[model samples]
Target: MARPTMEDVAARAGVSRALVSLVMRGSPKVSAARRAAVLTAAAELGYSPHAMARSLASRTSHVLGVMVSDLHNPFWAEVVDGLDGHARAAGFELVINTGGRSPARERRALRSLTSFRPAGIALLGPVVPSPAITAAADIPLVLISRSSRLSTVDTVNDDGRAGSALAVDHLVALGHRHIVHIDGGTGSQAAPRRTGYRLAMARYGLAPRVVHGEYTEAAGAAAIRALRRPFTAVIAANDLNAVGVLSALAEAGLRVPADVSVVGYDNTWLAALRHIGLTTIDQPRAEMGRLAASALISRVRGERTKPVRHLLRPTLVTRATTGPPPAPDPMP
Candidate 1:
């Protein structure tokens, strides 16, 4: 069967082609009753407007292109929810794609979003190179859960330093001096978190041992296995990594919060599960998304040219995974 078009919709609604076009463009000139008729007819015929054609005709678009870093992480989902809600409320729609955390794929994804000539773009936890991101400067851009020194870019990030510090403080308070930090290697915003951990350890007059790892469960597990000596507590780069450490510890016959304690960053739902009970840092994922959307939309509307950087504070969520360090050895 031939695809439905504006002409078909107009014919079905008994309205002129001009009226159908007006309705499709969402022109306020059309009466509610006539708009309803056209919409109903279009729906019945499964007619859909050609977004590209419409955008070209108007020289603008109501679409916001989004590039996500990792599709597997649940934290990004919460962020996307906030972004979607705010975008829709402001008469915009989202077009989403992902890079799966690869720089090459992210560059391609950025080009793809730019090709649509979207009103703006939002990058979620992107690991793409700075030059690649700067190349897409034709439209407004927002970086979510990432940081950039470029004045042209806007960013929304949780205070990674504070988050790491919180974990260290909690562990130290529980008499854990032999704590280890598994760092997110080459990951966005990893430096601040690593710095925070080091500073906190120094403040407590304790030696800090950092394991080089990526932001992944496998990395966390591997880092643990590579450790030379047993530590009383472990601070994972993120919740996903933390879970992996938990698994490794269990396999090693070490019980959490008894034989050892583990803390993670990002209070994702996985960290809150009753069985897992992971202590973590809350980063307000949804709020970060909302802010990113707001910043991008503002620039798209030509409301501001100045850069806006949102650095939100992080708080600790104490759970069963953290407790006093294991008892020392009995008399030799």
Candidate 2:
């Protein structure tokens, strides 16, 4: 079957091609009744404008490109929801792709997004090198859950240091002197959280034990199994990692918050599940997404040339996973 075109809509709506083009572009010059008639005719005829061709013709795009580091992580999904809503409300559409947390893959993804010649781009938890990010800044760019020294790009991040401190403080308040942190190895924003954990432990006159791990459930379980000694509490890298810790502890016959309390970061949907009920740090994922999109849009509209960095504070969501330390000899 032949594809419908603007001419078909114009013919059906009893309007000229120029009027139909103006209506498609949402120009205010068209009367409300004419605009409505053209839109209805277009819809009935399944006629829609070609995004790429239109962008090329006008040297403007209504599309925004987004690159996410990990699609498997629910946190990014929640953030994307907020970004999508705000972008759509602002008359922009989103095209998203993921790198699966690989630097090489992320570089390729960034290039692909740039190839589309979008009005702006947003990178969520990207692990690509700084040079790659800086090179991609020919268009408006925003980074979420990451940081950069590049002056051309904007960034939106939750205070990872404060988040880790909250987890440590919660453990300390529960009378837990022996606490361990499962570090997010090479993950974006990992260093600050690790530093915060160490600082908090030192402040409370407690030794800090950190096990290197990735931001995944498998890494969390492996880190737990690799621990030399049993700690009263464990702070996993994130909610997915916390789930892995729970599984490992169960296998070892250690009950959470009874033998060892567990805390996670990035209070994703998985953390709020009744079965999981994880105590974790809330990174305001949705708000960060909104802010990122807004900043990118501002740049796309030529509103600002200076970079804008939005740093949001994280909060702790206490759930069933955290509790008072168990008696030293409770197993006996």
Candidate 3:
């Protein structure tokens, strides 16, 4: 049998469908006795109102669609926690899907979310192009950890340039001169971070060396293996990539912080693990999620037409993986 609807509940309770609608919408105009009767009948008959149908009738929806770039990334998981919490408290339901970091897949995911005509849509670390973001102009949309120049989309991001600079400065303060950066090539947050690293190198009178790579552990290991120069320090694009760097160095018998130091961005939970203890730049990911949800909801409620760009500050967290350069050999 098909799922029971409000009409079924109304018939079972000897009430009109309009009364059932009022009760379902939590209208104060309904009396307590009648409301209780409708609710009891609904529960008895297993009648559940159709959320989309109700939204169509009222011209509003409490649904918020969320698209996550990479489901495997722990950073995105933490961000979703904040988004879920804030959206729930405000009476919004979330539906989630992943793009696996591919532009083509992300475009499909965007379409899938928009099909529901949710009150708002949040894209987490999206890799889709700018034009694709612009095409979704009819809905209230927000981008988290991605950027858009379009007025239709709001954005939330930590200052990646500042984060990169903090990593370079930390290594330099520890007597590192031959420092190298493994970049997140083609990733959403890569360009600003790469530019920041280059700027910091110029400011400190040192040559900037960037190895082209993606934001992954495999990329980290491959970038390290491809390096011909012997550097005292390395900055990985993100924590996952940094872990790969450590693995590659270990395979080469290079002791961490004894022969070389390493720094990572996006201080993920993996970075804080006792065995890892990686030094990294901390982006307030949860806070960014909260802000993204808020921005999208404000647009959904017709509170603002202008875009909101939230660029948060990042901090450096020192750990065992970073230390001063190794002592030079004595004169033979």
Between 1 and 2, whose TM-score is larger? 1
The Cα error of candidate 1 at residue 228, in Å, is: 2.0
List the candidates' TM-scores in order. 0.96, 0.95, 0.94
Report the C-alpha displacement of residue 37, candidate 2, in angstroms: 3.9
> Any runs in candidate 2 off by more than 4 Å, and if so which?
1-3, 14-18, 29-36, 330-332
- Model 1 is weakest, by summed lDDT over 10 consecutive residues, at 51-60
Candidate 2 residue-wise lDDT, 122-146, digit = tens: 9999999888998888888999989
Off by over 4 Å in 1: 1-3, 31-33
The RMSD of every model to the true structure, in order and in angstroms, is: 1.5, 1.9, 1.9
TM-score for candidate 2, residues paired by index: 0.95
lDDT of 1 by residue, 173-275 (tens): 8899999999988887789999999999999999999999988999999988888776899999899999999999998989998988999988999999999
Highest TM-score against the true fold, candidate: 1
Model 2, residue 140: distance off in Å is 0.7
By summed lDDT, the worst window of 10 consecutive residues in model 3 runs over: 47-56
- lDDT of all predictions: 0.91, 0.92, 0.92
lDDT of 2 at 327: 79
Candidate 1 shows a clash count of 0
